[model samples]
Target: MRRTLDEFNDRRWIDKDGYQYVATRLGEAIASGIEDLIERVETERKLRSVWQWLPDAISAFPFETWSDLTITVAEPDAPYRPVGRFESLLRETTTVRFLRPEVALMDLCFDLLYQLIAEGVEMRLIDRPECHRYFLSTYPNRSSEMIRQDHFTILEHDNLPSYGTGLLDDCVTISCYERDSGTVHALIDTDAPAVREWAESLYETHRADARRVELQKSAESVPHD
Candidate 1:
């Protein structure tokens, strides 16, 4: 006896568990592909020079989560020209201008992570100092609304001093103070091989700068007595 179309489409075949099972299978396939892609990327070049790997390592998870991914690089040579009311703060504080580059990089990273999570991406790893020690609130309804209301702060930290709403995207904001001399040497996208090359270029540039700074400091520190 042949089964009817209704039987084929019955609850037995279309139950929640069945749907989960199919999703699980597809997720696994996607995860495997991502892993393979990462592996090939790592193998083709030296992984040590890739800065984006720091964030990518944290994002790699067992599930298929990420969709739209973007990597932004700050123009290192550009002078910090404060926008709007930020101009006053830039004039008042010495550290703020110096740290603008670092702040911009952190802001970009946080914004991307927040957007991904809002779109239903589960975070696996985030190396930012702020997110390292704590797990931010993940309540969808509250978090989603909060993100929509305050996404601008991520873009402009000069206006918003702190995340007042408990629903703030914690991935970008660091609770502890960082002492890296206020410079973002590089930004990377692990998914793209070209980004790795860019990271290498930055690494070289910074290495040269470090050597020059050390020599100058050494010269200045010589016993003047």
Candidate 2:
């Protein structure tokens, strides 16, 4: 400890104040820079696993909002943690708009979504063709029933991000998945205005390019068991 202080003192990073030592202005500035670097590193650490899956727009987000995000990472012991968090958010929202590459909705979420739809909660979904086919095949009856409702809407977009973006009520969430396994690895949620704005913009852009999924056509496109 004494040797470290001597080194710092030699560099004028610390100065003697009677019997006590105080940091110099240069030392304070260096400390602040170090603190900022640590914060950036920590933020990167938290986002690294899911970073590749995130949309390009997220890269431009303000650094301050990164800390405000609620990142729910799937654990080895409980691999469904991210999905559970999203389901909880789904239950509370009256409106949902999402760009989905895959069907991350579990059985319970489908039931809750059904109830929400019957209660007139609005939902607009943009999904890839294969994912839409999978959903239709997996939940034939429910998909048919829900697609017929006025509150539910679907669009098919061939070029969607590997990750999913969901705008549930006022909150925005980015669901990252493992590419090979197709499992939800993390769910990043936030109410930051910048993120919400970006999400809404992206949703609208994709919605414009996507083809609407007609109830009759979609049903015929997929074979049932």
Candidate 3:
């Protein structure tokens, strides 16, 4: 059975021992995937392109819990387009390890990258009679006020979709952070063709942003001698 955030938190899911175990396993998986992508990029002599390395990086980690994983890269500063979708499968079962600084950093970077690419995605804590989990913003930011108004005015609501409903109605983004573990997974779902196209366009934008950052750094590094 799937565990809710409250149940997991009540059970001290983020305890040191549990956090360590999850982080270590997740880190190793991500590192391996990145390394493989790096090798392939080098062979193809496309080392300068981050997008070229993404596929291998994603393929490196097997997604066991998340049924769908989609990425969209947009223009620098623009919201991401839906790149593609993925289904995760776990290869093995193992015990937890301690969370090292490196592992934590890796997890943070992954989340940051996802947030940057997928702008306006909010994380909300949800509660149901049977389960609770952090639900990602499936709808655009504009709908937030309407949701808030509806929340206070209504006593009982039935139209809202549950987390991981696997429906294609609203574009959903699920950020998964293992309880009692350090692993973090972000899943995005959107059946909209326009959204997907936007995600792909974001890749070019990301490259541009990277170049701008480098330029700024170079400008700052110049000194009067």
Which model scores highest in TM-score?
2
lDDT tens per residue, model 2, 1-225: 899999999988999999989999988987899999999888888888777777777866778888668888988998888878988898889999989836664443778777889889999988877776777888887788788898899899988878888999869999888888878889999999989988889889999999988666767666665
lDDT of 3 at 84: 19
- The best candidate in terms of lDDT: 2
Model 2: per-residue Cα lDDT at residue 139? 81
How many backbone overlaps does candidate 1 show?
1
Which segments of candidate 2 are over 4 A away from where they belong?
Answer: 1-41, 106-108, 217-225
The global Cα lDDT (0 to 1) of model 1 is 0.30
Instruction: State, as a TM-score between 0 and 1, how close model 1 is to the true structure.
Output: 0.22
Error of 2 at 212 (Å): 1.1
Model 3 — TM-score against the truth? 0.18
Measured against the true structure, the TM-scores of the candidates, in listed sequence, are: 0.22, 0.78, 0.18
Order candidates by TM-score, high to low: 2, 1, 3
lDDT of 3 by residue, 90-180 (tens): 0111111111112222222333323322443232211221111111122223223223431111111122222111222244332223235
Instruction: Write model 1 residue lDDT over 1-225, tens digit each, in one string.
Output: 125324533523322354342224545565588887886565434323333333443245222212222223233354232121122222232121111223333343444445544555422221232322111222333333423432211111222211111111211211212235443333322233333333334333433332111122322333332
Worst lDDT run of 10 residues, candidate 3, spans 89-98
Clashes of each: 1, 0, 25
The regions of model 3 sitting more than 4 angstroms off are 1-69, 72-148, 151-170, 181-184, 192-225
Clash pairs, candidate 2, are none
